[model samples]
Target: MAKERALRRAAREAEAAKQRARRARIVARRQRRRALLTRLMPRRRRTGRLLVRRSRGQRAGIAVVTLVLLALVWFLVDDIALRLVLTLLGLLCLPALVVVALGRRTS
Candidate 1:
């Protein structure tokens, strides 16, 4: 009975060790895959502050309007130099324009 008990205990211990090793391998493979994926397609870190404090919809609206205006300028303007200047000016003035246009009206 004593010998049989010792043999059973050793068998259980060996099975447990094999399970531990299998889990370690799985974990290592997952880690390696994650590392490779991260290296290949790294996520962009949002470290810098957004210039405009607006909701996603608001920002999208502003971008659409800006693009429309630029497109109009591009199509309507005959001179390349004038078109370039206007586009640059529009972009430069966008922040101030947004603030003024969307500012709270004090009654």
Candidate 2:
């Protein structure tokens, strides 16, 4: 009975060690991949000014189109018909316009 218990204990210890080693190997592999990616990636070097880039331009264009659409809605609904709804819609779109304007001004 003593020998059986000792053998079971040894097997449990061996299993625990294997788990720890496997975890360590996974962690090491992740670290190595991260290192490789960092080494391979290229860094950008800007010369003169920070630009708006394409995404910002597209956002600004969308804002302009939306503003035009809102204006058209207001024009078509000019008899105070759904005035409150139109006002709320304009208010909701205001932040997007401001964001695009500010982004354009900055970049």
Candidate 3:
């Protein structure tokens, strides 16, 4: 009975160690995937930089669209002073749009 107990304890210990090793491997794989993703994924550019990267097509499209939409909205409102208020609106929208584009999806 003593010998059997010892043998069973040793087997349990070995299985525990195997489980720990498997968990460690899984953690390592996840870390590697995160590292790879960060390297490959496009990150948001910090504000206040002289040069920033943007999708030219998207940038142009946004600008043109914003201008057209704002102009239409402005015309509908028909306030001359309001037109001056939106002088830098397009520039402001660029950074905001960039932030949204780079935002992560929340579960």
Candidate lDDT scores, in order, read: 0.90, 0.77, 0.75
| Candidate 1 vs. true structure, TM-score | 0.48
Report the lDDT tens digits of candidate 1 across residue range 62-106.
999999999999999999999999999999999899888877443
**In candidate 2, which residue pairs get closer than 3 Å at backbone N, Cα or C atoms, i.e. clash?**
none
Q: Model 3, 1-107: lDDT tens per residue?
A: 99999999999999999999999999999999999999999996567644335555766866787778777767776667766667466556766776687553332
Model 3 segments beyond 4 Å from truth? 48-107
Candidate 3: give its CA RMSD in angstroms: 11.3
Report per-prediction Cα RMSD to one decimal. 12.4, 7.9, 11.3
Question: Per-residue lDDT of 1-107 in model 2, one digit per residue for the tens?
Answer: 99999999999999999999999999999999999998999966565545435366765776677778778877888667686688787778776765666554432
Model 1, runs deviating above 4 Å:
1-52, 104-107
CA error at residue 74 for candidate 1, angstroms: 0.2
User: What's the lDDT for candidate 1?
Assistant: 0.90
User: For model 3, where is the 10-residue window of minimal lDDT?
Assistant: 48-57
Model 2, 28: alpha-carbon shift in Å? Answer: 0.4
